[model samples]
Target chain A: MSECCGTTATIEAPVEPRVAGRIRTVALVGPPNSGKSTLFNRLTGLRQKVANYPGVTVEQRVGRLNGIGRGDLTLIDLPGIYGLDSYSEDARVAVDVLHGEMPGTPAPDAILLVLDSLQLRRQLMLAAPVLNLGLPTLVLLNMSDLMEARGGRVDTLALAQELGVPVAKISATRGAGLDAITHFLNRKAEAEKPVPAEGRIELPVMGNPRSYRQWATGISTRTKYKAPLSNEWTKRIDGVLLHRIWGPLIFLVVVFAVFQVVFSIGQPLSDAFGEVLNAGGGRIGALLGHGWVESLLIDGVWRGVASVLVFLPQILLLFLFIGVLEDSGYLARAALIADRVMRSIGLNGKAFIPLLSAYACAVPAIMATRTIENKRDRFATILVAPFMTCSARLPIYMLMIAAFIPNTPLLGDFFGLRAAVMLSLYVLGFVAALGTAWLLKSSILKASSAPFILELPQYRLPTVRSLSLRLVDRGKVFLRQAGTVILAVTIVLWILSHIPFHADLAGSVIGRLGQLVEPVIKPLGFNWKIGIGLLTSVLAREVIVGTLGTLYGADPATQSLGLQAALRHDLTLGGAMALVVFFAFAMQCTSTIAIVRRETNSWRWPAVQFAYMSVLAYVAALATNQAILHFVH
Target chain B: MVAIALLSDFGVEEADELDLSGAWKLRQLSELPIGTVGVVESLDLPGEIQHHLMHMGFMPEARVMVVRRAPAGDPTVYSIDGFEVALRRDTAGAIRVREYEGQNTRQG
Candidate 1:
């Protein structure tokens, strides 16, 4: 809908010629670990959200400027990157947009070059090339909150004068520094001004064409930090955190513990929701008097969407863990540890941020890959990004692992064992990703691995405001997406299963369809119950369980629960394993398919991804059930 | 053993007159070739070289350059691809090479 408001620049390679405007747009740029997003959040509020540019899966966040007193300004947050010389998809998009190469993407009237207060000199290296463009630039001194806490301060005015730019000191978290930015924005004169050729600095100092030292000196002079080199406390923390071994170990333990807690805490709430929905459905069905009205009340809409909604607790849990890790500054360290194995020669070490994000959701992760400068690495990374198991897959994994893996306690059996199964599924996704990468590197994507050239930013306490706003933005997208496409698919599936089967016809056409498919599914030990479950799952994989609940007499009292006992009573072991295999390979979620289409800019990849996944699901299910029947039966 | 240590972002042309032997430890340059590095052997082209040098990270402090030149030198490539770039033969002449270690025969 925002597209209707204006012709926005495509995030892929924005070459938006500046259209005539009473006001100019300003975009902030900085290195990947530069806290650019944190500052952007500070500037934009919850109005900022992520979207992919048409045809490219690149994630870009743009928000209307409200704080600068001029709601007329639009503040675009280009992906966080280390330099203009891109090595990944994110940096490439930033380069394209910075140059206004991406069509429909407007070049900023001016650039707000944000340098991390702790990592000023290095952050300026990224701002250097942008300054060369000669736009009226403002250098934002972010992370001032940390400076005070760490026993230091920066000389903002001196730094600004030295850089020949206005410098504002603000903690995007605490909401300081808006006055300086607003004063700059209110001036109409600076917006229309053209940058001199000297100010339009050319790409500098690769073969030593003289501009490198000049850029470095420009930053050195413009940037002043009151802290003595290597603050003692920071060094002490880094001694353990940046340690060769213990740091990574601590990080893994922390992440693993998060998953355990999520499963334990969220399971009961899931049950409550399931029970309430069923009770409501029963009341509605009884009041409607048992015809199409009864079917509609109990089966059609409620059952369809309910199945996927059951996964909400799981989805919310996943998002919470991700939010905490990112907000805690631990994710950055995770990236650092993963870097040695992940990054190769010829690529900047900074590309780690996006790759780590893939685990949460590939949509943003793929967009994040834009930070890499090398075309070869960028292209290769994009091509293989989908293989990383995103959080959406969590629901399907939880169901399959629960249904298939027996839950007798281990480790003196104190805690539930479902958590361990969940961890293994995560491990499987990771192994699958690595194997796929190895294959691509050897075959289609023969691009040599680039080395890690990166600036490991000093860690700081994350702001609650920024993290909460980000979580809100992400949560909104999940809900909106579910309410639309997932909602529709759930409706059609509900209809399909309600038509007619036996005398009373409590089950529908979908039930009949499942009966028809049972011959083929029998090898997987599926009865019509399993058949109906499979058909409904195609709407959204987790719907398989919810649909079964409705058909087998869902008691509103038993909502949001693992129907493991029920399924065990009704189906064989082979059938459960078959269901797991089916989900693992089926292209079940319509939302994901839609995202795939949006990301690839073509229907081809989504179609292919779906077909391959579906066929694999069927084959894996058949084999698992057939093998289990051959022995266990 | 002596060598010419010239810091350049983009590597030079294959045929050049300078000493490019022994190891070079690359520090940083702005814009170098995407995934390769080379040894610089001369000082020339102050204009074109500067743009690529700063972009690739051929900093004054680092040593990185061509480890070896291949037989047929059209897509002439350097071996080291890193933050501190190593320019190949074509790029080396543009950089003012110095001797940090061992310098070999200067074949023009």
Candidate 2:
């Protein structure tokens, strides 16, 4: 039947037209890994921000769906949630948004309920509660391709009749049968009955989960929907990949390979990127001539932005691997293997993925901690997430290792002494994360963690489209940071270092400030110049390299004389090691602090985190410096 | 002898009564022989943990089978409701299970 001529169209609309001139908001909701994101991407395509894991998308991503009859249809992709009663942050956000209680967001005009076709009955439990909201809703039975491939059946027509809503079978990943949903949406938009009528079929209150399951099962049986068994191929793969002995071994190798690839692959790309950026900056400087304006443009802006961009290669590789791992469902298996280690630190297994991601970048990692259901555990994870060796620290670590550690092959030419030193720094970050988490869990946030119950989605090949989109989105974030926060910090630092028009940097404002702090940090074997780098690095850890580059009177972008050469000329071995240790323990990223504030919804925690990390950094650096100097003497 | 020792570690007093025919015994889901189908008897975890597990399709009558365990033997994968879920041994220990009596056991 046509949507307008359907029996439900007979009732007179009692509610005001919600789509007058204002944009209509439609929310796409579903269970985890049910292809909700794929459908959202298909509907909104490329005009969306993607966060892969469930409960991690704290920021509500509203994308524009054009030509949907509603003048401007805003499609909000809510985080995948199992049900309304769960205590996960995503559930609360979903409930709050549906109730129009979330500030700055109105309740959705309609809900696009996505369900996994193979697991209809299980997913239907979520649909029941959503139906009770009385919103204009349509169900999309997604993954129908997999369903048919596995000899399963889902009668969309029968399901529509039973649920009293429009239903369409779609394979979101393959982009099949999406037009039907678009047509249904257009019809709903034209119907003028935005608000559901009181006589609409009431969804049974899902007070007893067993009863809800029975109800869902009854509906499915009548429709002749027999859920196919788990794929034999998946079982065979899991048998080996998740094997008791081999699983952990493979996980370690996989993680080790990721880091190896990041450094091995990323270094060359980063060097090439640096060379191009430096060439560009040098060309711009030559064109503009050598004045204060040229200096500010080249030394301040260009170099500052380059410092951020140089890490792009590493960041890209990291996210690419993470996207593949996450989409393939191996991350859940990895988490299972790490659960023992996680519990020892008073964290659940789910925290492992986020902690692992922190090695690439802490910003996304902090955001990824939302999947931890317990507030206390989530908080503990977020606070320590920054301690992981992020890609931003790569430049500084590489610089230090190059200057201090020899490149002689230690274990064959594949593993050099420098590589071991780099690995040790990463290990230090991990140990710090675990130790800090243990202390915080045992002392401050003493509440017990929620049980680790992770649903392992079927492993599948991730589409190139989603992977590229992820890479592009992450690239955009890095560029945005380089443009805004990093730019501002660079300009301010440039002015401070060049103020009073002083030819000698020692007499500049920043130089004076560094001198004042020099005595305090002298025990750590840092001079005033090193002190300034430490101060500026608070904006971003990479800024320390740029700050030092400028301090030593070298072009920061060109790496003229190279950073390692300059550091080796200026810093003692003990001082260089101390600086590395300091950066390792310090919470140097303002962006990380801002995210921590937003995620925890409290400035107090960020303040505590910053203070604690600073103290720890200072003490660790001091001890390392003293021990090294003592041994040398 | 090793299998018997491990079975005894499960403290299944009635392990002898089960025909010694390789029919699974009553044991914690963590100790349950992997690949052996069993019905969820009860979840003895703390209230919040129990509630969270129940919400995730682990009701009283649900049939769960161990799929695999990690190398550490701490988190084991279980298949139920036609989907796989990984649970830590500590959390899995809270749930008690009884082996399916026959091959025709009802699926969840």
TM-score of the A-chain for all models: 0.75, 0.87
Locate the minimum summed-lDDT window of 10 residues in model 2 chain A.
Answer: A8-17
Give the per-residue lDDT of model 2 (tens digit) for A363-418. 76776676576778889999989999888898899888888888999999899988
lDDT of 1 by residue, A271-382 (tens): 6777887788888777888676677646766765565465556556555565665666555455555554553322222344554555554545554454554444554455
Q: Candidate 2 local accuracy as lDDT?
A: 0.76
Interface RMSD of 1: 12.6
Off by over 4 Å in 2: A1-23, A49-57, A67-71, A192-202, A360-378, A390-427, A549-573, A594-602, A629-631, B1-27, B44-51, B98-108
What lDDT is reached at residue A612 by model 1? 60
lDDT of 2 by residue, B17-69 (tens): 33534554577888876667666768887765675676667766566877777
The candidates' DockQ values read 0.06, 0.35
| Candidate with best DockQ | 2
Clashes of each: 115, 1
**Lowest-scoring 10 consecutive residues by lDDT in candidate 1 chain A?**
A1-10
